[model samples]
Target chain A: MKPTNVRAKSLVPVARGGLLDRRSFILSGLAFSSSLAVSNAVASDKISTSKIDQSLPPWMKTPGNGDTEYGLPSKYENHIKRDVAEHTPETSIFSIWHTPIENQRGIITPNGLHFSVNHNGVPDIDPQKHKLMIHGLVDKPLTFDVESLLRYPMVSAINFLECAGNTAPNAVSLTPLDQTAQELFGQVSGAEWSGIPLKHILQEAGLKPTAKWVIVEGADGGSHARSIPISKLLDDAIIALYQNGERLRPSQGYPMRLFVPGWEGNANVKWLHRLEVTDKPAFTKDESGLYSDILDDGKIQRFSFHMDVKSVITRPSGKQVLPEKKGFYEISGLAWSGYGKIKQVEVSADGGKTWAIAHLDQPVLSKSLTRFYIPWQWNGNSTMLLSRATDEFGRVQPTRAHWRDKYASYSFNHYNAIQAWHISSDGVVENSYA
Target chain B: MPSRFLYPRCLKFMLSCLLLVTALGQVAAYADDATYTTDLGVALSPSEVSPYEITIFPSGKNLPEGKGSVKQGEGLYQNHCMMCHGEEGDEGPAARLKGSDGWFSFSDPLRVLRIDKYPILLISVGSLWPYATSIFDYIRRAMPHYAPKSLSNDEVYALTAYILYLNDLLAKESVLNEETILDISMPGKQRSVSAWPEIEL
Candidate 1:
């Protein structure tokens, strides 16, 4: 069945808040010229839909006409973009973000703006020439071209890939005035990944008894690599080639990426080219010194590969305004756990003083983002709102302070906390204390 | 009939004892280093060890020989650190290096700051780091994104000194050498917090 235009239809209601109104939002959209002119006149300073065409190169005049076998959202649908940036070059090419929790209804992120985290810049690779080599501690070293791997049976899973440092910046003491929780923790996203099971590849390579760790190396400029234990590879790893029902995007590891479910994002090596089984860790730079977390007591936590349980309230979070009303409002967010499934999520409308269990969406799969919603009536008084998540393992999200004291707020893994959102009597929604 | 069964049992017990004695003798010989242990029982010389085997822990024990000064580190910082971390180390489109009070600290109630209330040593160049080896290893392997693993050991040492100095943890005149690196203590060295939920953060 063809994909439905669900995004456009759903987004229609959101526009009603302002220019988001039906008539104005559509008319002002890049798809329509007349409305673009009107919107441009109203907001002269901002980049109007008409100006976008001028910024594009001639070859990109009709992004749709390229006749892609598998298409992404129309180029005009540019509202979705990466939430974070790298240190140098100031490009969001490798940047990623969690989907607005309240807005996520499906299993896959739209291709136009799927979250991405690249160690090096996204490399332009030709999939036709791509090949995977399995060597090292294996009994039979085998090389498989992309075509050969496709011949094997494939399985699809809806999973999320979260960077180990997804929320590192937010964990800091002084947040930038302009920064938001979404930008800080948004470097995570879920997708329906289609690929061959990693176990199948290891079997073909004839894994030796001594093979304890398998090192995955990417083809990016940094040659980013990491060593994962054999147990994890056989457990739920995937050599993902397709995302969201289509071939991988160039930014999301085009031909293939190693997807280690429920692990930190770095373990899910992108642009996968080689797999070398060995008796010990690869001691790659990413694992040994950088990605490793230095705990208290003068000891560094090494090889912390799993992302702990984490959840965040997306809407009315920060930089969003709420309407002043005494009526019922739906509090919604997303939660997930690396260990397993998310069993429950609790919401606090009174700065965590009291918590009410929120309703979770059905089919809460392991390592997948689960949608949650709670109905509440705003009393029109200034109050703090927060949401905490508890996974199946009974791991509950902590407060910011709780995470800081535990992880020392130094390294970025396992910073699961109940995010606080301050609602003012004036209906101003800002990130603040309870 | 009872005697016949007893005879077979005694014979079987004797055979098992003989096998056990042989196994014990073999183990003793292996411990004495008499046999060249290949796939069975033998110890390989240090030179015969795999070149890929290097595990750098947080302690300074595994550190390599290198010396760096804050003066030299300043030069490296200007060239490599200014763009992302900024000259003051407080500004970055990616992540700020200094003045991260509300960002990471939990003490500040404005929001859940990750750096607030964190032992400053936990930050780069601080006491929270258990090993000085990681600094040299990280800089030597990945830094200045454009050119990763390009820095020499000495250069990494210099950069490490500079970063530590920037965080105000190291003195300006302090010299960081492989021998004296472990002597430096981070502020969070004594703070032992567990990641487990029951530990009471």
Candidate 2:
């Protein structure tokens, strides 16, 4: 949907290149524009329903469309959708859909729009027939059907799931400058997931002292499997059954999926069924080849589950144009960490040269997306913009160069670097490396 | 009714005691505390779970039975995989399996020269996969792209053998079974390490 007009035309500059301290101004009862969200700025005055007569508008004159059992976003919101990034050459099923984070707000990703990468495609599983088995090196080898599994004590966690390969800055060929923040780094999304804490199941199975690793496997045709340490599963893992308080969408793994908070996404095996405890790491095809990070020394780095802190400016991102060449724009984006809550996010309008603190949206949940904002008065100049997020653990998101220096060489996965976007003098925004 | 009268009536008293015990037992089982274990799943026997134990561990655990020679694998590859994996396993739209070995050395880290294999990156059992068993495990789980798990254990072994043979790691006549596959030392076996020093974190 389109917006009427901006209300925050005058914001005091807090840093170089017209960066305004959004939190400070808002707290002091000063700023925030209503029309900042009116993207696709093809026309200045697209929709100003408020300016219409006070008596009635088009919607108010008639009864709304018949209600249905299931509801959907308004028809105007159809523009916001998950971008299908790529699939196996032509198979189309082995694919990855990028969440349009540019259009989304707040921490929880709508269940339907959550980013997904499927190996053998989304399986329409019958929850009635679905069963999760926890076996090997355990006193009791337990098989839990959906009914019995639901009987277990349930726990909910609001956490972010990020693909290991999300935002591989060095792999520019895969994600070019013409794309939006979602196309570049949409593999990460936040959600409120409710499920039985896996430790409860593991404890019931009676984990053997020798059980050091648990090879969690999906029931999908790909049999997508990963060797996760038993310790992590016991710590904060969940057998997630519901997403955003609803039965998980088919793509989100209906009935059940493994949820290892703060760990890499692939390890959270969707359509999860089996967990085999073992003494040593299994080094399955996924852990050994697919998700393994080939390092500088040519040695493969496996089980680097912790996703580092990262952020990206989604509003006015690639392909979007600023309505005015120079005006007040509330810069908005997401910052999150595998380590913990994002402590601070610094916005840089002049690339990395000048940095200013941006407001971390309220109730900054740990291991969840923290939306940040900074009201800026654009000077209509060709500028490079990026953000740096420092997590609670003191781990700051690194620059592309710095990250490459640390990891080095072939990166088929796990690259979190500062995403820079350029705004041209003509108001066109493009993904930037400058 | 008197408390003494209730205590004296054994039938009603026994029934009440049983109900109280059962309620207490359930309360103990489904406790609200996070630390409490529900012990709620059905225990299955090993034999019942045997059919689904598909995971093949690096240490050769769960490696299936049946054998296939590289010669047998070549024929099977031609029949099933050659369409996508290419006639020789090198020329394919999918991930190339076999290639002439000479990795562009990035020892200096700064100067990484792209030499030898270009355009199509080489990531196969011979060049990259740390374990030989994984080649079989993967082929068995996902192969032919169009039809997964359609291959019999022998066919999976056959493809694994052929791929290894194409990489020059195995002879044409060499056969691979559960035991033989374990003995085949892969080049990357020693080079793989966890990104985190401790997997616990």
Residue A406, model 1: lDDT of: 58
User: In model 2, which runs have C-alpha deviations exceeding 4 angstroms?
Assistant: A1-10, A23-56, A87-93, A169-176, B1-33, B90-93, B100-122, B199-201
lDDT of 2 by residue, A1-434 (tens): 25324454345677898897664453423344543565675658566667556688778878888987989998899889887754233253257788998888888899889998887788778888988998999998988888877766687778999998787544434344477788788899999988888887887788888998898999888788888888888888889989998988888877799999999988889999999988877777777665767676667677889988988898979889988867768899999899889999999888778899998888798888999988887888999888999998899887776776655355547788888898999989998775
Per residue, candidate 1 scores C-alpha lDDT tens digits across B67-137 of 88988989998998787655666444323343332133443343233223222223443433334555565
Give the TM-score (vs. native) of candidate 2: 0.85
**Candidate 1 Cα outliers beyond 4 Å, as residue runs:** A1-77, A86-104, A174-181, B1-201
**Strongest candidate by lDDT:** 2
Candidate 2 residue lDDT tens string, B11-50? 5665565589788874322221354335557778999789
Worst 10 residues of 1 chain B by lDDT: B32-41
Q: What local lDDT score does residue A406 receive in model 2, on the 0 to 100 scale? A: 59
The superposed Cα distance between candidate 2 and the true structure at residue A212, in angstroms, equals: 0.2
How far does residue A394 in candidate 2 sit from its true spot (Å)? 0.6
